[model samples]
Target: MNQDTTMHPRDLLRQMFLAAVEAAQPARGVPPYLPPAPKGRLVVVGAGKASAAMAQAVEKNWPGPLEGLVVTRYGYAVPCAHVEIVEAAHPLPDAAGLAAAERILERVSGLTADDTVLCLISGGGSALLPLPLPGVTLGDKQAVNRALLKSGATISEINCVRRHLSAIKGGRLAAACYPAKVLTLLISDVPGDNPCDIASGPTVADPTTCADALAIVRRYEIELPQSLREILESGRGESIKPEDPRLAACTTRIIATPRMALEAAAEVAAKAGVTPYILGDAIEGEARDVGKVMAGIALHVVQHGQPFATPCVLLSGGETSVTVRGNGRGGRNVEFLLSLGVVLDGAPRIHAMAGDTDGVDGLEEVAGALLAPDTLARAWAKGIKPMDALQNNDGHGFFGALNDAVITGPTLTNVNDFRAIVILDPARD
Candidate 1:
């Protein structure tokens, strides 16, 4: 659907936000897609910020006995009576994550062809399930994770490196349940929601080569453990490929994705009486650079009304990166907003907002931030420099100072980034 030809700009913006959030709800897609109970045993396993809720959704609706384990980001866990839900660190591996990974691997053992394994995959599962390869400790994986998170590497690039170093990721988990029928239901947080990229594609076949993983590491300059370096160099731990016969019985389903959520937002925009232009759902690059480009487009709409007329809204979804330099918080959405604020310089009639659909930008509690016509002018009046904030990677503080931070704590599901640029007509004197 296209933008709304009939609603207010603010109303359109709000509706867009609501649509993105609605598309990610666990209850919306996770329940009805479940496979029939296994004749032998139905074992559930998953990892992500939404795993806990996904687990609960399974427990509430399943007609047969359900037993298993799943891990989620700390503070994101929801209660479930049957399955054990473990909380662990995210974006970085920790000891708790290691423990959970070990337990998960153990759960998949001894599965027969009659058994069914339901795997719930979502964003943040990469770090939530960390079981390092031989001779590499959890600390080694943590260091690499910290480096990658700060390196501005894309999600696909980061996961390539991660797949090589873990025992559970990169199709190993699926291999463990060899004879069983594995059904994977995923909530995509990556740009394209490629099954192999989500949670490192534990239950799906991997077509990525070990050399591919090595190239990504070198591209990102991510420091790796001596053993990890050898593991990739030797190319001994290659994951199951697309043609691997062992995975013939496996099935993967993407319940939600960035594109779907973007479409939902577009529908909301149409309902709100505003014209919406969807640039693309797979955008990538440094957050600040993208913001500047978006600012250029927004300015065009206001000045020439060429690509889109005034009273139009620009919308997009996808994950953006941030190369962390400063010690301050670095949510990609906030970084984008701060950069846009500088480029826009509080231009008359142009306002924008960039936010993570998961409701947490980077590691900050705030979902993202917003900007209005006077954002930059107001910051300059208070002696706050937008460029300085960008340099310090303190987008949160920069937006917080202007009281423009969008704070929505723990919205649960993650589809990726939701960005909107609202353009309106100039006021009459």
Candidate 2:
């Protein structure tokens, strides 16, 4: 698609975000990395927000017969004739996920060395494949997940706990496959794209220990169910280790990542006659704090051109955390954008957009929101206090009132969060 010079800056920013998401689509990202057809039966299974779409991509590209099951977040499923698509809760586990996890484990249990088990994994897989260890109940896992999410812990910390509590995660699934050749295809949504951290490494070996999981829980002061505490304390729920013989035949490959998405957006910016500066694809921190830092960078670019000249777009991709201290709607992308708007404070010829690549930000349906030079002015006109909204973690509400929210219903793939700030030369316009 050609860049229309007449397109509004907000529209341009949104276009870049869309291009990033499109680049990470399972159909486009999965096929290139798919392993060759196995000698024996191909049994596919996976859990994540993108697993269903990944399954569909696999089926569309595979030449041989394939039958499998994949569980995705509710409403994230894409129709697949060969692989069964199961819908489940995400960022939280449900009975549906538990059942699906059990069935998936059963499906791969008796495979031989010649057989191939294709494991499709992505972000949100940890919560989507919550099969509690023998002593821990589903409720226990759910309680810990809620605590970890609210406690301001990073994704790695949260997944560390999930790895230990789960019966199927942290390479146990690969172990269950025994001598089968397990090929795990990942669409990384984590900051570092660590295969062991994605989807809690269901089909890959985990190097972390139950001790590490316990430490994270203690560091965050997350109260766990008594049964879960016992499991961790006794080391009963420790995940499969890196040197475990059971995982000897398993392999993992990342087909899509946050960096790839950012590169796509950078290309879009370049096509629009804007120099694209990719700051980093693995930036991580509190949403508001990261926004402030990004704003400083944008200002530096505008005033000094130390980093780069004007008529450029600054791009970054990573998962930022939101420590919810308010009752307002909380989405990390919107939080970052709102904080950015406040920092810019009506800076001329500057615009920005931040959104989750999955098309859902926090618990809201909206992907994220856009920010213009007049964003603060518009909010003031509407009698909405920007600081008050920011304090309340209500970026969604603030952006919604101004009708600036970017809504893209489920992109069917995830590569974490995407943010872009366009700095244009006022003289050029």
- Give the TM-score of each candidate: 0.95, 0.97
lDDT (CA) per prediction:
0.85, 0.90
Query: In candidate 2, what are the lDDT values of residues 1-429, reduced to their tens digit?
Result: 123366667777988998999888899988888888888999999989999999999989999899999999999988898899999997779999999999999999888999999999988899999898888888888888888887888898888899999899988899999999988999999989998889888888788988999999899889987888889999998899888988888888899999999999999888888889899988888999999999998888777876888888999998899898998998899999999999999978789999999988998989999998889998999999999999999999999999999898988999999999998876644
Pairs that collide in candidate 1 are 3-276, 4-269, 4-270, 6-273, 7-272, 7-273
Candidate 1: where are CA atoms >4 Å away? 1-14, 427-429
lDDT by residue (1-429, candidate 1, tens digit) is 123244444446666877888888887879879998778999999999888888988998898898999999888888898899999997777899899989998998999999999999899899999998887888888898888889999999988888877788888898888899999999999987788888888888888888999998898788777788898999876777878777888999999888888888877766655567889888999999999999898888778878886666788988999999898788899998888888888787777788898788998888888788778888899999889999999999998988888877677788899998878756410
Q: Candidate 2 — which residues are off by over 4 angstroms? A: 1-4
For residue 376, what is the lDDT in candidate 1? 84
